[model samples]
Target: PLQVKRGIIDKQTGKIAGEEEYYVDRDECNRADTTLAGLLKLPPVFDTTSGQGSVTAGNSSQLSDGASATLLMSRERAEALGVRPKLVFRGYAVAGCEPDEMGIGPVFAVPKLLQRHGLRVEDIDLWELNEAFASQVVYCRDRLGLDPEKLNVNGGSISIGHPFGMTGSRLVGTLANEMLRRKARLGVVTMCIGGGQGMAGLFEACL
Candidate 1:
């Protein structure tokens, strides 16, 4: 979520807020086709669709969306200015699943993250699994030991709306805000996509 506020902001542009934007446009169309062709340089799909020849560019899609944020300084820096920040960020990770089985992404991702941090499933205080589908969340809970009670506390896409390209960033904003609201130290955000792909990210609230 982004805001248009009336205020004098202070900060150098050098500081990077965690958010980033990635867009694909017409320039990428030929690259996409060429890349597919090269990968066809191998076997399997190439063996099947042999001699499809160098792929040609086709129609492209245009999409646009908005998102921005507020950055928090360290506790010491905030206190120095007599301002206290509410939340701190911890870590983030993303995973991919087969588009068809996209729903299972979190199941694979959650354990990977826990192992990476040497934490257990129980250590996660909250979760904000994107409700790409009712079954995605349902399946994740049963497989990842996620407590349903601690999942998606503020209602999700099912209630709001799904804005394609915008969903990822939106989930990050929502999960971070909700973690602060709930006084949770750690929270996870996961999303499943069409074509059996998915991603999950974990964050820690700042002290």
Candidate 2:
């Protein structure tokens, strides 16, 4: 559900934070066509439609000319620079998987990360699992027993175009902002990499 600051909602953003419902206003959307009819007229990325197969243009992440960056430094360095940090990187883990099943990478990586920190799935306050695909996100949620309520409260890569190399920066930046807004203690940024691997990074609120 959208946590609307105003009681009224319509022509605002969306009712549910998902891939399809997200709106691309004015200059944000660089797609050839933004209309529903134009989108429907386009062919699926795969041989089958969404009803037949999980892969579709709607659920897939597209590469765009997008960029995001974050300043990273040790606690001492931050202190020396007089820069108070907003979060601390607790742990990160990467796990291998079949190339074809790469989307399931988080299922393995998340456990390793949490286990290393003596934490559990339930202990996580928020998650920014990249929406590489709906199928993968759904699988990771069920396999890892993640709470949907605590998952991607906002739409993900599917809604926001996925810019390849900047995904880490983008996800982490978004995670940090949301964590601060919600006052969440633990937040995770995770995604499945191409060539059969999944990566997850755990973070804790510092300030």
Candidate 3:
């Protein structure tokens, strides 16, 4: 489903440019190495100096502000509301990282949640990654070996506007709808937050 959208920075002018659609192909993503070394435009995870093993890099500023919300009702509640419920939250997890390295939050959170449910990362059929910054999502993808094609089918807030106070629900609804569209059974939503929090939620489409 469409999860996040983003734009490019024109280095010469130091301004954001027109946004574009980014997609992850599930098949291609799972086959890559642990570092996801094959992706064409992946964001850099660490900086290396002369003969240095590894070093941290600064955060990217290509992020926009946005919010989303979704309403979920129990089976009984749905009946009372006179609406059919098509999905349910299965589980959720959150992780922390250095504030400046906030992009890696999802990488830690998703694996733990998936393990808690006894589900392998491969078991998930779809994914929605909140595009806080292009680098944030890319960092998770490389670290987690997530399939880019299966990552975001619709698009993201980068292309759409990030309307604060509504992104969570928006992402949930979009993922649920995408699951129904593909007739898939499982989906996951993940996002990186400011100040070092990474959040992820798992869901299944109800019959």
Candidate 4:
């Protein structure tokens, strides 16, 4: 559900404090051949007649040029340095699936992680499922019965662009920030790998 505010209201008075304005601009990358154009122009490469392709540039992750990094430290070291942690790493899990249906990797990985940690889907506050492709994202979200509001509120890789190796880190950063904004307690970051594997991590937001 998209939240729309037409005017600003006073927190104390509970009245319209001022007029508000908003704009909806066209995405700069909206084009027929661009990956950010989404699944419209792309074919199901894996299900193509030629057997060479259905995965189109529009429907797949864009080849982006960028970098990201995440630093980890022991609680003692972090506290000693007066560095306030944003999230605590709980645990992680990996699972495998058929190479042809590699997108289903998260379907297996997430359950293994929850079972290992003795948690359930409703226990999580946020979910960062990497949008490697529209097909995969749609499949995983439906299969997991994820809440639309709790999933990728700021848009996914398809809209922001995926920087391959850095995507995992990006997901973590985004999830952490969103968790903080929502005052959420727990979040999950997960992604599917190329070789029929999926990786997932559990996080507890600080405050």
- Using TM-score as the measure, the top candidate is 2
- TM per candidate comes to 0.57, 0.77, 0.66, 0.76
How would you encode candidate 4's per-residue C-alpha lDDT over 75-124 as one tens digit per residue?
A: 99999999999999999999999887787788889998999999999899
Residue ranges of candidate 2 with Cα displaced over 4 Å: 1-44, 47-51
Model 1: per-residue Cα lDDT over 30-136, one tens digit each? 23344545544543321246655332211112232335455557768888899856455555555777676776877777777777788888988888777544555
lDDT winner between candidates 1 and 3: 3
Q: Give the TM-score of candidate 1.
A: 0.57
Q: lDDT of each prediction vs. the true structure?
A: 0.63, 0.81, 0.73, 0.82
TM-score of 3: 0.66
Encode model 2's per-residue lDDT on 1-207: one tens digit a residue: 232232334456856333333333442424564677765665556656455554667657666546798988999999999998888988899999999888889998999999999998999999988856777888899999999999888767766777778889988888888899989999999999998999999999985
Tens digit of lDDT per residue, candidate 3, span 157-201? 444445656667888888988999889999999887779988899
lDDT of 2 at 82: 100
Best by lDDT: 4
Distance from true location, Cα of 136 in model 4, Å: 0.2
Error of 3 at 80 (Å): 3.0
| Higher-lDDT candidate of 1 and 4 | 4
Q: How many clashing residue pairs, candidate 2?
A: 0
